[model samples]
Every structure is written in structure tokens, then in C-alpha cells.
Target: MKIMKTVQKVPGGMMVVPLLIGAIINTVAPHALKIGSFTTAVFSSAGVASFVGLQTFFVGTNLKFKEAPEALRRGSVLLVAKYLAGLILAIITNKIFGLSGFLGISVLAIICSVTGSNGSLYLSLMGTYGDSKDTAAQGILNIHDGPFLALITLGASGLASIPLLSLLAAIVPLLVGCILGNADKDLRDFFSPGASIVIPFVGFTIGAGINFSLIIKAGLSGILVGLLVFFVGGGLSILADRYINKRPGYAGAAIASAAGNTIASPAAIAIIDPKYKPFVASATTQIAAAVVLTVIIVPPLVAWMAKRYGCPKFDEQKAKNASLQES
Candidate 1:
């Protein structure tokens, strides 16, 4: 049907299309796909946990130690910048609205939604507009896939306290993947590609768990959160890339979206603190909507920024080198 080709034409179509379809299916006929064991397992929220764990493992396998240094450097700059911006939002929301949340948005939801960046989207944009080091930056940045960042921010902000073990448990899949991928080149080769391949399943699973009605309730707020992340996070990241990394600033803007995995955060937090349970469903839908919103908007914004304000240092150096050769 050329569906994939059509979807590919969109900036984040690979993940967004499946998520939307899954949401529609879940919304229209919640039990229509539960016809069999396999369908029941794959087409429901129960399946999301499994897929996320596996997808995380695959993402981990792509993190080779060889890429660690540059990845850590650039990744940390972007992560800290994005995280702080989110933390500020959390604090503001707390002061203004309190933990119960304001206008259907919880402090936990806002922090969780904004802190996670879409690694695939960032890497895709980096591949198009950046150099090798930029691409490798995903290594450290990818660690935000799960709930650890939100938990940490909550704990640090004194809004919620999490157990030490839960924090460790959050990273187990990533650590395991890194170990396996580093230990065997064959394993890395086999699983690294699966990271991208598994994204559709990730999207579908996230969507399947979401109730579209919740999306309706969180619609405007979700879009607002997405915009906040895209502009504020992008701005913080661009400054870091320019001043901290001393590179073109577009790499920071490239990380402007909420990762699809972040749709799971509120539920994860609810697991730790029952106080958060009431907010989980709505937060999931909100984050899911935010993921779609950012995916649609961030890539083009990054491309435009790169073209207009990209650091000329690298390109100018290439120009000089070319002229010297011509002379």
C-alpha cells in the first residue's frame, strides 16, 4: 500500500504512525484484537512492558564502549541542560499547582514528559546534519529511556522519594545490553539494528495502553508540554552545544522530543508511589500525545536552525582547505 513510504515522508512517521493506529484500535475496539493468545499478548498494554524491556535491551546493545568518551561529553551537556529545564518546570508546577497537578497535569507528569528525549529522532537528525561525534552522543543520552530520570528529579526536588534499588532496576536492561554488545562484536552487529526495527512495536505498545479519551482530556496541556520541551529544551541544548561543546548548536535542537518510552513513566512512578496512580492513565496519554507532537515539529525546526544558524567553523575550515588545494 506504500504506507511505509508515505509514513517515511513524515519526520517521525516510523514511530508515530504505529502509535496512532494502535491508539485508534484501542479506542474503537478495545477487545477486538484479543481474539487469541498472541493477539492478547501483543495488542494490549500487557505487551508494552515486554516490548519496552526488549527494546531497551536492543538500544543498550548499540552503546559500544569505544564511543563512550565523545558520547559522554556531548550527551551529558545535552542531558543536564534538558533535565534542568524540566526540573524547573516541575518546581514551578509544584509551587503553583501542588502535587495533585493543575488542570489535569501533575508535576510528575510534566517532569517525566519533558526530561526524556527521542534518541532515534535525535540520531536520525544527527546523521543528516551532524558529524560522527554528534551521532555518537546518543550513547549517554539514550540512558533516559526509562523512569530513572523522573524518579531522581522527584527525589531531588523532595516531591517524592524512591528506593535505591528501583533506580538500579531501571537501568538493568541498558547495562545488560551494553555488557553483551561490548563483549561480543557479533552480538552488537546483530542487535544494534534491532534498536530502530523495534521502534514500531514500541510505539504500538505505548498506544495500545493509552485510552484515547485521556488524550482528549490532556490534549491542550499535552501539546503545551510538547512545545515547552521543543522550544525550552531545544534552546538550552543549543546553548550547551555552542558554548559547552563548541560546535554547531543544532545538535541540541535535534533532541527536542519526548521519547516514546517516556509514555511509560507515570505508570512506573505510580508503581513506586501509589499516590501517583490516579494520574498514570492521563499522563501516559498526555506523554504519548506529546511524543507525537514533538516528533512532528522538532525535526523540521532543527533542520531550519541548522541551515540558518549552524556553526560555520567546520564548513569554513573545509572551504579554506578546498581553496588551499586549488591554489
Candidate 2:
């Protein structure tokens, strides 16, 4: 049946299909796999962070010491571009609608939802359409995964004491793996397969955390947030990659999706600032919808952009072959 080949033909299918399967399980039974032990661990929401951490470590192993500098530049540009997109739109939303935004969308939702990029999904996409250096840059994109960056940008930087450890906690695993891999080629090869191995699980765990019902609940406003995520994140980020980073912009487009962890950011921000408390529920739902939508939207966007710009996917010698034949 060529099952693996068939799956690979779908845009971001490796990650996306598992995510949808998990979402279906959650939506239907929602408790069938929560019986503890490895079953629950592998098939439920319990493994989200663990799977992501494991995936990050694997991605690090593929990166060479020589490529780290350019990876940093690419990753940093993506991080800034994603953040700025969220901040600009969020500030404009705030000016227009204030904290209690109209149609159930808030500044908090815009900031938290759009600013963060999905690291697991990015790694999977890069595996399909990018090279080792491009995937290694996931280490830097790891920083904005949770509430840390949004908190700082939300005026909490000066007044409130935010936890720097959360940010450190995300990056440290990737850094350690990179260090160990750079120190030993054998170790790098050993862990190299580990990243791709964990991808489907990462998607499943994250999807278990999501409820498709939220997309229905979010409605028009939710759809708007999702489109905002794709357009703003994709648009600005692609431009930043081309002009600022001086590279093909497929990477920026790839990273335009919301982080799976972002659904929690509204509540996290609300806890720190009571002003956001009233909007948390609505924002969370909207962000949840945005997360799902972007995962669907951005992958194909990246695939198309990669083909358009000639990215070097490890799996795609054909892309290179086509380039040579044309020349």
C-alpha cells in the first residue's frame, strides 16, 4: 500500500494527521486513554511538553557546530518577526477595542496567539522541506513557545516579576543536545533519528490537549484570529526572512502557526494582570481555534513556498534534480 509514501504526500502529513487523530479521540471519548501508565502518557495530553522536549533534543543532534551561527541568524529573525507581528496587531487591537475586545477577540488573544510559533510542527516541516541547519534553528524558536515572551511584551516586563526559568527551561534541552552532538559525531548520528521518531507523538499529545469543539465555539471571531495568525505571521515573517535575514522566506512562512502551548497563554497572562481576567475564556477558545487552523494553513504554505524558492529538503533530491535539469 505504500502507507508511508502516501502519508508523506500530504502537506505536513506526518504531524498533521496524528494531531487530527488525537483531536478526534479527545472529542469523542475524551477519557478512553487517560488510564495512566504509558498508554495515557503516549496518547493523552500528559506528554505534550515531554514530547516537545524530546523532539528539540533530537533536532539539536542533527545540527553541526559550523552551521550554528547561520541557524541563529535565521531563527532570531523568525522569532523577532513573529513577535513583532503579534505586537503590532495586538497594540492596534488594544487601541481600537481595549482589553475587552469586540467580537470576543482581545489584545491578550492576539499577542499570545500570534507571537508564538509551534516548535514541534516547525521541526517536522523542516524535516520535510529544509536541511539540518534550518531544523536546528528550532532551538531559538523554542524561546517563544509559552507565555514568557508575551508576558514581557504585555507591559509586565517592568512591573511584575516574571519567571525567566520558563524561558531557560525550554532552551536548555536543545542547547545540551547541540553541545553533546557537536562534541561527538557518533552521538549526533545516534540521536539523529530520534527527532523524526518523536514527531507523530508530539502531534498526538498536543492534539489531545485541544478540543475541536473550541473551533465551533470560536465562530467568526475565531476564524478571524486564525487568518490573522496566518497572514500576519506569514506575511511579515516571509518579508523579514527575505530582506532582513537575506535568505529564502519559506522558513518564515513555515513558522506562521500558533504554538500548541499558546492556548494557555491567556490564562497565564490573566493571572499576572487582572485586567485580562475577564477575557481569558474567550481568548483561550479563539487561540485554540487559531492553533488548529494555522497548523492546517501554514504547512501547505511552507511546502509551496519551499518548492517556489528551492529549499533543500533531505527527502527531496528530486527538487535539486529538477533545478539542475532546468539549468
Candidate 3:
């Protein structure tokens, strides 16, 4: 009961429970189900689940396309900040630190792409910061990490390795959700509940991919890489939020966004470099672990920073609810 309660309290924890179960199954009985490539199956299922979840959430919630402009502006700012941070860092790492392999590039790209949990969670927590316009921006921006990583990998390698089609496959559902969200107010409300269901399955697939053996092999180097990206990438987000936006919560928001790149990077890497499967797999696992850690840690850090900076907290929920009510 206590564990269940704790999971309920945690953002996206219920969704993660299914993922944990899947991982346990893999750990205990690796050969139980030869499900025609676990990664492909899991990813495919996740895509469908996400689509259903988003449709359900948005179907009932009122969405205003008029506010699309505001959402786009904010979303663009955040996306640019995220993209440049990753691209610049990856280049620097490659040029200066001799970290030029696919693993190194993918790791750096992943780091930059990391973004926080969708603004909905923050809105829910902060209660007042709920703006549907902002949430819409957040939703659109949240999904950009995968495409941006793919673009970066393509640019760096001078090879079109990451499958354009695969990236599209991942992106189409989210895009559809956004469109459906704008089309019908009810769609957002309907889709929101399903997010709770879909997220955990995604988490389970991620956990199932984790291999202790690979982590041991990568050892300190991988750990160092992960930490460096988390810290440095996180710092860049802060700077962008502060200097670029002159907003307090923006820093934390940026950090949150940067943290989610784990999901994006591995998928991109798998498509790009099939030969280095283990390296990509290990890097993906490490990135996912980093994302979970950052999600747990960065919000409080951002809250503290916001308090210190005396920046007004944006109540995303209030704004969202207001928008819905107005609509």
C-alpha cells in the first residue's frame, strides 16, 4: 500500500510500474518471449499507446487554436535553446575531447535533447501555472527532441544514417495528437488520462533494455559522460532560461526538457549505427537513467533557483484551466 501510494505521488510513476514489471521479466526469464525483436515491438506499441492516450486526453479538453501563436513562440524559444545547447556541446566534445565515435556523438546529442516532464506535470504540481496555451507549446516542444537528435546525428556524420521514416514513425502520432488537440477541446481532456497509462509501458520497455553487463563494461567512462552531459547540458539550459528569457522557472523548465533526451537519442542511434548496437544500447540505457534522475532532482533545484532569483512562478494549471473554461 505504501509503495503504491508512493508511485501514485510520483510523476509518471504508475506508467513506470508496467515498465519495471517488463524489465523484471527480462531479467528473470530472458527467453520467455521471443517477441520478434523486443525493441521494435515495444517502440511500436508505445507509439500506438501514446496516440490513444493523447486522443483520449484531448478529446474532452477545450483547446484554442487562437492561442497557437503564443504556444508556438514560447515553444520555439525553448526548442532553439535545447537544440543549440546540444549541438554546440557535441561539437565541442568531438573537437576538443576526442569523443568522436557514434557513442560519443549520440551521448552528447542525447544530453542536449533532454527536456523536463511535460508542462502538465509541472502545472499539476505548481497548481497555478496551468496555461493550456503553454501546455500546448510544451507538448509540441516536448516531442521535438527525437527529430532534433536525428537532424544533429545526420549533420555530424555527413551520412543519412538515422532512418527518416523511423523518425517520422515516432513523430506522426504526437503530431496527430497536437492537431486533434487544436481541433477539439474535448480531445485534450480525454487524452490526459491515457497519458498515465501509456507512459509506464514506455518506461517498462526502457527498463527491459537495461543490461548490467554493459554498464559494467562502460564503467566510469560512461558514468562520466552521463554526468558531464547532465551537468553541462543542465547549465546551458539555465543560462538560456535566465539570460535569453529573463525568466526564473524557465531554467528549470529547460533542464526538464533536456532530461528527456534519453528516449530520443537511443532510437536515433539505433537507426543510425546498427553495427554498434551494444554501445548504442548502453548509451540509451544510461541516458534513460539520467533522465529519471534529473526528473527527480531538477524540479526542486529549479524551484530553489526560482526562489533565489525572485522570479514569479508561472502557474501553468491555472492558465490551462482558465483557457478551458473560457473556451
Candidate 4:
């Protein structure tokens, strides 16, 4: 029916709608997807990684041979700006709160919230607002996920290395897609639809991993942490994109989201060092709220930024092909 047009009208609807739907299911029944067969395989949390990886390969098909360097620079800008925002959050919170933490939010929450992003959500948002190179930037952003940042920031030692395999998992598929797309232009066009096709499924998979109830569990501080993740972390990332990366701020706004898995960082960090133990539960809760809030918030923020400054799309070839077909 008119569903496609209706969804396209919303800000990041292709991703946000399915994500919210999945969240609703998860919060309500939670086990409905566990009915087995293809239902569980595709709709369950188990499918999130596969969907994300597939989208990455398809997005790579859009990037050409020349834009690779710009993607690296764009990624670097986002990486630095995102991490600096988190580090600043830690320092400011430490100065004002003095380790007791303000409200229910704690150092661990800010550390985890600021240091990285929702890579899957970033890919989804990029599918809407970003160019091929913008999507390629995700390959470099693999550094943001996991407890590595918390461990390093909290001064915990000897846990794990830089996750080389994670880097490879990100880069390899993109490179393969790039080589093939460059070799056959029509193949790029053929596979490009896969990027959008996978968004709803991936969004749903990611949402299945979240529980909106956690926001309530976190209380007012939970909401505050979400706003901080959006304004402090998301805002600065936007600025970096505009000023440093020399583009519209959509990509930066896109990355401000706290990954759903980031909820576990507090406990993981506490495992490494007992000093962070007392704060783990509260921090975990606050981060969980941030994850939910950011998902609900950042897509609209990116959409607004895009509407105001113009969408940062880079599909001139696609545009040209469409024009030729019309003629």
C-alpha cells in the first residue's frame, strides 16, 4: 500500500520504525520471536551481526576507488571527536561530582557512552543520510564497540588487545565489495538495493536486543544521561563533521547513539578493576537508558541536521543513471 511512502516520510524511518517495533515486541512478549525456524533466525538478536555485515558489503559497493582517502579522514574526524567528547564527560563529571557521581549517573556510564557508538545504527543512519564513503567510515569505527575503551579510560590494565579480528571483519567485506563494484559498474547498481533492504531487518534485530523498561529503571538520571549522550557526545561529533570533516553534520549526529550492547560495559569494567564495582549497577542502568534514548533521539537529530543543511548524500552516479533511464 502507501506504507513505503509513509515510512520514507519519517526521519530515518526505514531504520527507526522497525527498531521501535522490535523494541515493543521485546518489551512486551520478548519470546514471540523464539517460536523457532526462520522467525527466530532472522528476527532474533542472533541475526543482528549478519544483517549489519551484509549491509556493510552492499554499502561498500557504492564507494568508488578514489573516495577511499576521504573516508579515512572522515572516520578519523568522527573517531577523535567522539572519544574526546567522552573523555571530557569523564573529566567534567570527576571535577564536579568527585567520584560519588552526580545523580545516578557515574564515570563508567559516561566513559562507555561517549567512547563509542552504535555501529549498526550508524550503518542504518548512513544508509539514509551518508554517502558511500560515509558508510565506508564504519570500517574504521570498529574501535568504538566493546569494553576496550572503558578499560583504557579507567586505567585498568592487561585485559585484551585491539581486537584485530573485529577490524578485519569490518574491512574485508567492504574491500571485497569495493573491488567487485569497481570491476563491474552494473554490479554496484545491482547490490546497492541490499543496503536499504537490510535496514528494517537489522533495525528490528538491534531493537530486539533492547528493553525500554531499562529507561524507567534508570529514572531521571537515565534520561539525563541520554540527553548528555545526544548533546555532549552527539553534538560534538556533528561539529567535527561540519568543521573538521568539511561536510554536513549528519554523520556526527548519526554516531552519537550509544550501542545497545554498551549496557554491559560497566560490569565488564568492574571485572577488570574493583574500584569501579560499586558504580557498576547504576552505571549499567544509566548507559542502558542512554542506549534507548539515543536511538529514539539521534535519528531525528540527524534528519533535522540534514534537512537544514542539506542531506550529505554522494550518489552522483546513481543520479546520472536515473536521469539516463528517464531520458
Best by lDDT: 4
* Deviation (Å) of 165 in candidate 3: 6.7
| lDDT string, candidate 2, 1-327, tens digits | 797788778777787788888888998989986988999988898988798788778877777778889998899999999999999988888888887767778888889888988777787777667777787777678777778888888988665554567667877777888899999999998998887788788878877877778788889889888988899977999999889987777888888888878888889888889988988988888888888788777878887788777677633788678899999
Considering TM-score, which of the candidate structures 1 and 4 is the better prediction for this target?
A: 4
**lDDT of all predictions, in order shown?**
0.73, 0.82, 0.48, 0.86
- Tell me which of candidates 1 and 4 scores higher on lDDT: 4
**Residue 89 in candidate 2, Cα distance off native in Å:** 1.2
Q: 253-327, model 1: which lDDT tens digit per residue?
A: 888888777888888788777888888877787787777677667866776676677533346667999999999
Clashes of each: 0, 0, 51, 0
The runs of at least 3 residues in candidate 2 whose Cα sits more than 4 Å from the true structure, single-residue gaps closed, are 314-316, 319-327
Candidate of highest TM-score? 4
lDDT of 4: 0.86
C-alpha TM-scores of all predictions: 0.64, 0.89, 0.57, 0.93
Model 4 misses residue 274 by how many Å?
A: 0.8
Q: Which is the winner by lDDT between candidate 3 and candidate 4? A: 4
TM-score of 3: 0.57
Better of 3 and 4 by TM-score: 4
Name the runs in model 3 displaced over 4 angstroms.
Answer: 2-4, 10-12, 15-25, 31-62, 91-135, 138-192, 242-327
Query: Which sections of candidate 4 miss by over 4 Å?
Result: 157-159, 314-327
Per-prediction RMSD in angstroms? Answer: 6.3, 2.8, 7.3, 2.6
lDDT of 3 at 129: 25
Which pairs of residues collide in model 4? none
